[model samples]
Target: MRDIHQVHTLTEAVLDPILAREPAAPRVTYYDDATDARIELSGLTLANWAAKTANLIRDEFGLSPGARVAVLLPAHWQTAAVLLGCWWAGAEVVLHPDADADLALVTLDRVDESEGVGEVAALSLDAMGTPVRDLPVGVTDFATAVRVHGDQFLPRGAGVALDGMPVAEVLAQARKAAARQGFSEVDRVLSSTPWDTTAELIDGYVAVLAAGASLVQVVNPDPAQRERRIVSERVTAQRG
Candidate 1:
């Protein structure tokens, strides 16, 4: 067996353990509507989705090991899958703002044009159907990239280090934050904010996923009803 040092990406680390686990275990749950307040996913589903999407990322964008891929998406199950997929493929992921121009510019400067960077992918969440523009040279729509790449799981190096104070530890801390926000096995998550929103970043995105709960994103939810739905739906988690 190869050592953890031989491992190359986040995707590899997450998927391997998930695959090794029993299929009956809960892994991921996708919430697209408000009908359900409590939802959970099995471990098998999360592993399969991560593998499929990771394969798509690899084949479509030609993402290589240690490359950085920026994500601009809402807080949906697909978003989590893609982020993990990128990591599985050994690519670094930068969460980017969905609408702020200044932040977008800063993110671009920080991530784009850097040497050893891989493809930069964008996701359009505009309700106005506005055209996406001004993306960096290699930037492509994430959906298009996935569609172009067939579903296939190609294993990479060993996996990420489970050693002292590693990235996984950081993820664990994020999970603890989610639990503090009320996320539990029986609760489903809904976000009125973007996935990259600061509040969602610290509390909802990583935390909800770590808690193994389903997540839903309301792109244009009414501000008045936002809190009501969150409470009624038992959305234990919030972007705080």
Candidate 2:
């Protein structure tokens, strides 16, 4: 595996290498304080989900390198899979709801907000892979939809990483953010930060990938569980 610094995108530099080197190691762990749910993914498993997502977007939605994918999802393990898939398919991720996109990835409640921008796929956010209930007639259920796709995929090529920024620039910024936060490959970071913007995405999400660090991302964090998670998850660093 090459160094993390030698990267075109996270899917190429980070995910691919991690899968090749430590396919069974826990790379990402997620927690939902509201539901009291937890999920863990190894590098191979994450790559499989990402490959399925890439296949869905590239084949079903006709998305390519230049296409934009609006992500209305939160910071969860599934979100990480979707984002990696988008990057693998060479689509630019749009965090802003107002942006035009070829695809919109959203949770069940945000269906109406993704209108006016291509196709929409709703996520149930259920760890059990349940299909989202009451999805609109045209809207696709992400968990069910993504499952039909094959786990093997070839890159369509890479473009901008997020919004209008170039892929190289976005990754470089993420690397800097990782360094600023003192991230290292051996660290397991527990993070509660929201990736609601490009900057936050770089700081909270991409930085972990850039540094080749393991992640324990929490949403709706329960304060009481933080200490327990740090010990249980063997977290070496904290990020918010």
**TM-score to true structure, per model:** 0.59, 0.93
Error of 2 at 21 (Å): 2.6
Q: Which numbered prediction scores highest in lDDT against the true structure?
A: 2
- Candidate 1 local lDDT, 1-240, one digit each (tens): 545446545444334544554455544443444443334445566555566667765666565554445455555555666666666665545554323111111222343433343344554423232334565665554454455444456656423311222345546666677668777655566665565643455465656555555455554455666677677656655552
lDDT by candidate, in order shown:
0.52, 0.85
Per-residue alpha-carbon lDDT of candidate 2 for residues 1-240, written as tens digits (9 for 90 to 100):
333223365478667667766788888898989888889998889899999999999999888776889999888899999999988888889897854788899997888888887899999978889999988999998898888899988884676778888678887888899999999888899999998888988899888878888899999998999999899999999988
Off by over 4 Å in 2: 1-9
Candidate 1 displacement at residue 199 in angstroms: 6.7
Q: Total clashes, candidate 2?
A: 0
Count of backbone collisions within predicted model 1: 13
